[model samples]
Target chain A: MNRRSLVTIVSVSALTLTGCGQAGQGDVDNGDGPAEITMWTHSAGNPGELEVYEQIIADFNASQDDYQVVTEAFPQGAYNDAIVAAAAANDLPCLLDMDGPIVPNWAWAGYVQPLGLDPAITDSLLPTAVGIYQDEVYSAGYWDAALAIFARQSVLDDNGIRIPTVDEPWSLDEFDEALSTLQDAGYDTPLDIGAEDAGEWWSYAYSPMLQSAGGDLIDRDTMLTAEGALNGPEAVDFFTWFAGAFEQGWASDSGTIGNEEFNSDEVALSYTGVWNAMDSLDAVGDDLLILPPPDFGTGPAIGGGSWQWGISSTCSSPDGARAYLEFSFADEYITEFADNQVVIPATEGAAEASEHFSSDGDLRPFVELSQRFAVLRPETPAYPVISSTFEKAAKDIMNGADVGSTLDGAVAEIDTNIESNDGYGF
Target chain B: MTTDSLTERVVLRRRKVWSYTAMSALAVIFLFPLVFMVVSSLKPDSQILADIGSPQAFLPVGDISLDNYFGVFDRVPFGRFLFNSVLITVLTVGFGLIVNSMAGFALSRMRWRGRSLVLSLVIATLIVPFETVAVPMVYWVSKLPTLVMEGGMVKYDFGWLNSYHVQIVPFIANAFAIFLFTQYFSTIPKSLDEAARIDGANWFTIYRRIVAPLAGPAFATVAILTFLPAWNQYLWPLMVVQQESLRPVMVGMQYFFQLNTAWGEVMAYTSLITLPILIVFLSFQRAFVSSVAASGVKG
Candidate 1:
């Protein structure tokens, strides 16, 4: 062929391929073996969770004739990056699971579509477990995890410390006294707040404390900035005490990540989620006491939200994806997920039926904690940015940075980011 | 003469002793993490946590078992990930040595127009971090065409997503590899190439039989360097390859990093993945060290 003709042909083919790649995602129902519905999850290593997911997928596929659901499980640490990359390629799966706080950002970025879940399912879930932005439900989870102060009843009794309950959690003064009393009782570091945990964990594990101090990541009234809510008096109060925990040697930032410090008797108390409850119970037996988080001024609070399900914006068979979600949220599956993964089931019925969190169950208090004290992270499209910014500020405060200036700097950064993105559509 | 010679010998012996002591300490410091990982892999998580901040962490003295190894296999298909990593690394290194070495020969030994500018451009890419261009690269690769066998007929597929080639191809033509080869090949005597040409040999023949044989250290250096990155590839494979069957071992490390990380399993997986790299480095220790020393590059 002539050189010019060959060039023209190649260019045309290239453009054709580009267009086809974008259009190809929409061509799933071309009689290609039951309109394949691809689902992506972050349960690659958790055999318990992955088993439940596989069961759901198998049951859903067998229950259907028009659509077949397939799943791809990525490791939790790498799941977010994979989703972002796939969205860029227009190759996102029909069914995608994302962490709850990320729902708004992904929704605003056109990665996920707002769900139209039946209100029966939406109302059945813990309020914090349903991800909503601008009055639109974007995602819902099968389970929600709540954090608690894990203590041993025997130790508390021996140390002459009051056993705090869900109704009457330790106030700020009581908690401080308990830490001091434990420290004097020969436990060098009395609390394991998991300060060494990094990134989104800083926000997920600590922001509820900020809320309990009457501060928040952002002003939810406007959802435009973190000005007063973050750098205000209440936030400073929370952060000062947070830093003081480390400064006073009541907690150590160098300890292990999970309940190990508590399990090994290196620490008297552990600030951990329900995921660690089973391990602590295994070690401490009936002495394990899952106490509610300390109430600073407003009420006790624990960071709420966990991984949730959402449909990708570019899904070819979104209805089928929704069908799978709806099918997967049945009480039996939810209870099984709760029992196996040791997370609080999102629905009350499931919680009631759960082997781990039902009436008289070992970890029953977590259900009350999730119901009463669960505080959702700021739900705006600016959340991803807000989340990291809060993590940095909280980490700095924990490391003894000046609370006021650190919080102010964080507010400015968050405000600038929101403004830079036009308030992240508020 | 006897007194002076005896004093000098004594001084040399003391110096040898001091240097050996210092080197041994440094070696122990470096090997501490590896020992801890292997030892921790055999113990339960609780014991691993308890042994922290103590010398016992380095010793497998209590509860040494292969449970974590069994857990590693139960959690992930270690064999599949190992095969994928080996296949990708071998193919990448095998192809890389040929393609990059030739480019280096042409750039360094042959007379070509714009050769200097091309070499500068290739090296310039070294400054651009892979992360900065990862999204764009993902887009382009998704639009690229590939051939697929559909019912015994070769059909053109649009995207390279989820396939093995996506992991191997984009990484083969490495900028660092090319730069290493060009600099290494440049150090060889041009007289060898001229002699080969005098025998009426073509440029390809000279590159093959004359300069390439002399650039043994260069080939070894490039092979080792290419193998490391290929074996340790994480982000690219995670982005493009979605199938569990096609994932590399580095990405499999994430499997153990859940809300409550499986500490023992993490140590086990690291110890397992680390074996091949240790083997590769130890097998070519002398050649690798000599090449790096000659090239003045730190591995």
Candidate 2:
């Protein structure tokens, strides 16, 4: 061959190799022929979880002949961004594991399809697990978690303090006294509420404080009634006192500290979710103790749904997707998952299967606390606006801004957003 | 008179010492974060929190291991992610230089119709943020059906955000790159191209034989800028690639950080990701410094 022919041959050969490389490894079996269904889930870095999922997929493939599910995992942070882009590109997967907050958002944006759950399937889930928006069940939960307190048992014992139990939950005053004692013991900060970072602390620590003080960020009945309450005396009093703990050197000034900080014994207490208990225990090992969230009369505790699995709107095989969901929530699978993974289950069977809860510590406290005081965050499409508003107010408070004014501003911002988003009331 | 001369020499020496001190201080300030990142990655998670206020806490003193490095591999598909990143960066830089240089040469040297207008249009596109065009671009890419394989017609739905093409293709012929090349190519003597053409050489042959060989400094500039962005790209990659297997190091590192909140592991993974770039920079430090200096002089 001439030099030009050689060049052409080489280029064509290179192009052919590139094409072969692009053909991903997975045989599609969509009954009619071989079809590949791409599945995306938010479980990227957890090796243990990924392993289980791989097993599940293997089992699924073995049991089925119609379709092959090619699972792709992404971390929680990138999951939402990927979903939005995927939706825009019309390349959404056959199934997606999403957070509860995103379900309503995607549904409102008309990117999600209703599962149309049969009565048998719907009956198995917790009433609250049915994440409904606009009178449509957009998604269903596979796991549930509640805002609870995780404390270093060794630190509490060293300070001669008795940790609160589920039934005899510490009152707000008592909780403050315990924190003060720990602080006075020369531990620079007694609590790692993670106020600096806009995460669970807003829901677990600040929201509960507001609830205990007879103030709600959003009234459950009206959803609009709490604009005044956000900047009210009760709310301000709790925030100022909360800020005082930092001023008194009882809480770290760094707001970005997370549960891991507490788990590593950097702080004595962390107001985090029950779901973090296993991970925290893994970090600290045997020195950890679970406590009920502080109580203030009959007030609600900030709670929200955990992880949920849903079939994608663009899924090619709905039957295959439905079967997977059904199998995932089945008694045996939920039991095995909860037992092995240390996750809180969303179904009654899974909850009952907790007789086998093997964290070697009393797991009943978390279950009971979740049952009693757990109040779901507003499931409106406007919840992200609320979360951002809360985050801004929390940041302002942490930065020494006047709590009342900051919260008032946040409330106003949320109100404006709600009004602009067609004023969908709860 | 001799005593006075000796005293003057002493004064000059003192001034030199003062200047050296000032330069050292600036170097330390610039190097602090990088040094700290390296040290912190070696330390245990607990020590990171415990010694937050102490300089000693920055160093990995006790119980240091290669655990964090291993952790990165175990927690995420680090190897595959690295491979994907290498593939994307290599393709982007390699293809980018060829396409941009050709266009740059044409626009700057060749007398083509609407050359100035084309250059302006290319430059104008740079003003628009990628995010603003992302949704529309995704829509257009999804609608493109020609990319399908011929045999099965397995529609190559450009699922642009989820593949290598999205990350590398749109950015291959960057306006900045074209402009940089054009500026640098303009500096080259037109006589070289003219001489080559006088010998019966075609435009392609002239470009190959005369223009490209003389455009080394410009090519280096384009390669450096293009390669760095391709390597460090986060938002675009995060937006595009959902599959863990397809993600680059930045996206993989994010998952590793979140899943394993251990400071040591985080540091290790960060060090691993950053070490390659650091090594590359150090190896080509002279070229980088000279290129910047040359670019500054030209500007």
Candidate 3:
């Protein structure tokens, strides 16, 4: 061909290819036209979870024509680092999944948007879940799991010990007796307390112990005065008992043990979240039994409804984001999502779907615990600092340091952090 | 030999034995962590914490398994992450060497007005931390128009704010690379350039044929340093690349640990990510050593 004809043909081909590519790209961004929306999530969720989410997006696209959501997952450990960089770059995502403690920190920094719930959707949500951040709803959570103790029923039964039932939960004395019995029966690890793991074990395990002993990290009415709440005699006694268990070889020195240890019958008992039950039982094959968190006469163990979702302040489509949140709260979606994810629902109607709990006997304890004694973590800006102090003190006490003095020192550090940050009250 | 001479030889032998002992101890101290990582990668997750500080604990008390290695791929996108790291490191080193060398050659050899001023400005940028410029640079990149295509369509979406370009391009012409190249280039004999010019060669031809070839040792030095920082980069790439598909190995490793929380998988992934870089260094140690020695002699 002549040079002129060749050039013209090449140009036509290029134009057609570009047009086709544009059309394909447009299909990704809501089928209406080309648009972009960014999403950020913590890395803990399985990548497999995205398959379900993609299907949801496809269904949403089929139903309507607007903006499309492009999801991005960040490592949980480096999420803060990513957020800081994104803020500096002015390229933050439209939506983000933040940890419960980090929500206030991000909100106060004006890095997240305060989500005003649709009145229709808000009416269905549990009041406690909706008003977590402040008067204005900052985020919505779909699935939640409580931190609870998982025990080996066969081991207890073989030893002629009756385990706790829903009507008659084990008292602190009864719990200790069980641990002592398991140890005397020659089990190397009778209890798997996570004192050695970083702040996580204590945040999930010991903090509840403190609450069950009738103490809190901070008083809701007067947040600065953690002196009585966190460092009280009840807290000291609880730590002292926990340390004694470690010293007696009822628990291992390593605070971080695998869930398989409990499931594999290597350890008789372990403290962990309800989400671990399915995997744990699968490994051990049904000799497992779930129990209410051991009480200390003050109340049941204090942990519940722990995951949260928030919108990034940089979101270009807040309305579309809210619609997604509303859809997550819908009854059918919530029931399916919660059942598949193995978590408690955050909304009222979704919670009533617990009638299906009879299908899995192992899930009954979690449902019962959620109903009777689901206490939320103290949602405050000082929570991270308080959690760190508690963890440090717990570690020191576990290493055979004086429990009373350690509690006092941790309370002092927490109070100082709170006072310095002017994060005194709710 | 006299009795005193014999006694002195015995003392020297003892001293030699003591020195050998100390060196062996130092070697163990330096190599233990790596040994532990390899051994742990072969262990079950249940055995990791129990065997942490004890080598005996890692001995094959049970059948060894490749579960951890399989877990790394199953739980995280190891293959994609490996590709991303390779792409970023190769592009960064390849482009970095060329751009910095040209700028360095110009500054050192070419006599232009305000040459010192330009060199000084480049040197000054080395002191300013990249963190301070990150936000402004992202904004500037975001505002750049998408590259246009045929029929007035914007084919090349800049998505520069969260793309490979943002991670690799901002760093391609690094200040330190330029400074190193300039310092090394200045030491090259002006006679080479003069000879090339006398042979009727242009400036571009002189650079490619005469100058760059003569500065092989300097280029090797730049490549070693530049390749390392690019390979080990975590924060900047993490900031720019939002999609997991685009994440480099370091970010991928972080995600792997978060999702699995199994130390065995962590060790496996860590070993996988670091092994290639370690092999590269070991393979090129002689050249790397010579480059350093040459730079030192020149300076």
The fnat of each candidate, in order, is 0.53, 0.36, 0.27
Choose 1 or 2, whichever is better by DockQ: 2
Candidate 2 residue-wise lDDT, B76-158, digit = tens = 77778778888788878987887898899889889978999999999998899978987777667555432435465444533
List TM-score (chain A only) for every prediction: 0.93, 0.84, 0.84
Interface RMSD of each: 5.8, 4.0, 6.3
Predicted chain A of model 2: TM-score relative to the true chain A?
Answer: 0.84
Clashing pairs in model 1, backbone N/Cα/C closer than 3 A: none
Question: Candidate 3 lDDT, tens digit per residue, A1-426?
Answer: 344764575465344323322111111344457355566677432554555456565665565556666666777777777776677656677777766666666776677888766767765654334435555677666656666678766788988777887668888888888888887887788877655557555775678777888888887676565788877888877888878878888887664544766766667888776667777777666677777778886877746535466777867677777766665566766666566667766565675675434335457667667767776667676777887788888888888999888888888888888888786435
lDDT of 1 by residue, B127-180 (tens): 999999999999899887876555555576788787777787788787888888
Candidate 3, B100-191: lDDT as tens digits: 99899999888899999999999999899887876667667655434434366557654355556566767789888888888988988999
Instruction: Count clashing residue pairs in model 3.
Output: 1
Best by DockQ: 2
> Pick by lDDT: which candidate is best?
1
Ranking by lDDT: 1, 3, 2
Steric clash pairs (candidate 2): A28-A34, A28-A35, A29-A35, A29-A66, A196-A255, B161-B240
Better of 1 and 2 by TM-score: 1
